[model samples]
Target: MRLTWIHPEDLIGHELRQARQDGRAVEAIARRWHDAGGHDAPPMAGASPEPAPERLRRLAEDLLDELATIPSPLADREPTGLDAVISACPDWPGAPLAAPGPDLAGRLRGAWAGRAAGCVLGKPVEKIPREGIRAIAEATGNWPIRGWFTARGLPDDVAERWPWNRRSAPTSLAENIDGTPEDDDLNFPMLALALLERYGTGFGTDDVAQMWLDELPAGRIFTAERVALRNLLVGLASPETAVYRNPFREWIGALIRADVYGWVNPGDPARAAVLAHRDAALSHTANGVYGAMFAAALAAMSLTANGPEEVLAGALRVVPPESRLAVAVREAADLARAEGDFERVLDALHARHADLHWVHSVNNAAAVAAALVHGAGDFSASVTSVVSAGWDTDSDGATVGSVAGGLLGADGIPDQWTAPLHNRVASTLTGFNGATFDTLAARTHALVQETSG
Candidate 1:
């Protein structure tokens, strides 16, 4: 068999562009290409290409399969208590608040504070309908979906109050929905705390990613082949087919949350990206990895500068130029600079790219783009812009917020954002109840010390 290598760029040119420009159906193009020779098939002869939806879906499914194989073995024993969890760390000095080396302490503090703010940011809108989000945005003059929590109308100490569950009260629109607000892995801050608690200071991105997969409950999850198929479909095609397509909204949060891994490494965004890749592979691929890389690179950069443009530039350096993610980010940057209204920019991007996937790569990439451009390096502004623009709001907001928080440090985050959450949050993961930001940070710090030492 004569082997022919199909570069990602070739796929983009032959498949992606065809779907975008030639008006060919993704499935027909894909089927023709598959029949002609699989990826090596000659470009369809005079085939009018369909839109990129099916191609996007195929890509998503392949990416998911790639993600499912990254192995993560659990610790020899499950943690019995907080002390048991803390005891896992031998390197942590367990230093008092007045201890030396405030930089480490500061990183720890910022991680916790960021976690709290993340919870507050995500709590009110966990299950909010699109109409509700729009209404809130219209009523408050802030983009409701993204900027709802940032409005000055909320209480001063909202986040700080223990048990943020009360804050989950149905947003006028959700009032009729039954049942209390539930927290799951989809909630970024809570997930962060869970990882911190389980791994302690040993929490590297690889470990975190594995933990996420392990949470799928061994027997109930999809097979590796099924995961691969699902990834390939969703990544390369449209995510509109919710039944079988990848749940990108859920995955992007996981992908972006790996930034703290990069942040701990310092000036090693590549290492961060690598770590993120390992984790992301468990559930995503291609642009999924790009999403993780973007978040990790931004977090790594945040350790050095507070400029959104600079940080985005740094992130772009890490992702391949041939990727849709790169293209989307570039487009977003252009829109952010040229357009005055952030919503308009998103609307424009959607008009062009929405068919690709509403919650997958292109749209999420747009969110990252909006955050960096409109956020201008302000933690609140970046998060607000990313979230408010809608479409995978939490994932984009979390990534933007985390990177901004990492850059600004704990003290740099506004009091209003941090003060409301009171440095506390919880997750659905079984082992990490009653976690505080300070404790999670201390555990993460200790893990790094142990790993690096």
Candidate 2:
């Protein structure tokens, strides 16, 4: 069967790479493909339409299923503590700082508002090519991206060459700004809030899957989530849904949905991570799952941790010591420390993660770490840097914004970012229409007080 979202060649190539990673011999499949006239699926469909190539492709597709069934484990150390989760890399080389005072309401508001503002900031540039995002920003006097982007004063040619994300540009750009728009980033947080309100920490993967089916529109989901939703409709189970024909399992979808779990479990990164894992398990596995856990833990830590660096160590503590996502986060943080220059760090991230898909967790997680390191806990600096660096723009912005927001609290976020959001946010979530950040924060703080207290 053909996947609507993936190119046939990409699927074939991806499976082969995984096969290689597993130390499985692809000699038979490789030779078979070569013997059948290579990767093309024979475009011509008329009489004598090549059946051999199609057959070869089918064989490859089936072989991946066979490979998926066999468990190929990695030899890596398990996590023990917050220090050096992976590679036993030694805990972050810094003394711990005092936890923040209990100002739950303010921190929750900051997280919600920051997430909204950051999402709008990156929306218009979501799929803009890396260079195109830079060119558009530079042309519009937004280079180094200090604040929200404006489409004003653009040459027609430049504007045409790097057009804004058609769906989001009208509202997201600076000049056209209004109240916060409905984005899945915010919607999932709302949904997570609903999940916790109903099921508390006892919620399971099936609960998450049910929440999507009940409240989320089919079109509202994407990547692994979309695939998993489709799987549920066909009567598949939780973990199975995550892998069934889902090439995007390691993408950033789950990570984007993680903040609420963290928000509700302030200063408890491990518990926050556990909650995130249940939600993430509905549609992701391995690194995809780990990314959500890391973000959730980061947000939780950020609520009380003294700084971004300390929060990052707490974030790393949640995931396994042996995971690739943990390694990438550390490497990105270490790289930022070593390089010092923001642009160089961005370039190195791209170079290291070039082989993965544009939305893969590894590089994007690195981008987040880089932004946190470079931004040095400044709200505007981190949000702008991650968005400008541009891989999965909106996701990075929301993630960074959430973490930074928790650290700063509502009063600490710059008025420039918060004012444009106009204290209004939209969502597809049921009973959450036209919600304000203040309202969400109040509700979240109430939940935390009731549950965690």
lDDT of 1 by residue, 173-238 (tens): 122222112233224434554565576544554564455455533322222212333344345322
Which residue pairs in candidate 2 have backbone atoms (N, alpha carbon, C) closer than 3 angstroms, thus clashing?
Answer: 85-321, 86-321
What's the lDDT for residue 310 in model 1?
Answer: 66
How close to the true structure is residue 294 of candidate 2, measured as C-alpha lDDT?
87
Instruction: Give the Cα-based TM-score of candidate 1 against the true structure.
Output: 0.61
lDDT of 2 at 194: 90
Per-candidate Cα lDDT values, in order, are 0.51, 0.78
- What is the Å distance of residue 29 in model 2 from its true position? 3.5
Per-residue lDDT value at 440 in model 2 = 90
Candidate 2 differs from the real structure by a C-alpha RMSD in angstroms, to one decimal, of 5.0
The most accurate candidate by lDDT is 2
- Where does candidate 2 have its weakest 10-residue lDDT segment? 41-50
lDDT (tens digit, per residue) of candidate 2 on 365-441: 88999899888889999999899877889989999999899889999999999998889887777889888999898
TM-score quality measure for candidate 2: 0.87
Candidate 1: Cα lDDT at 216: 37
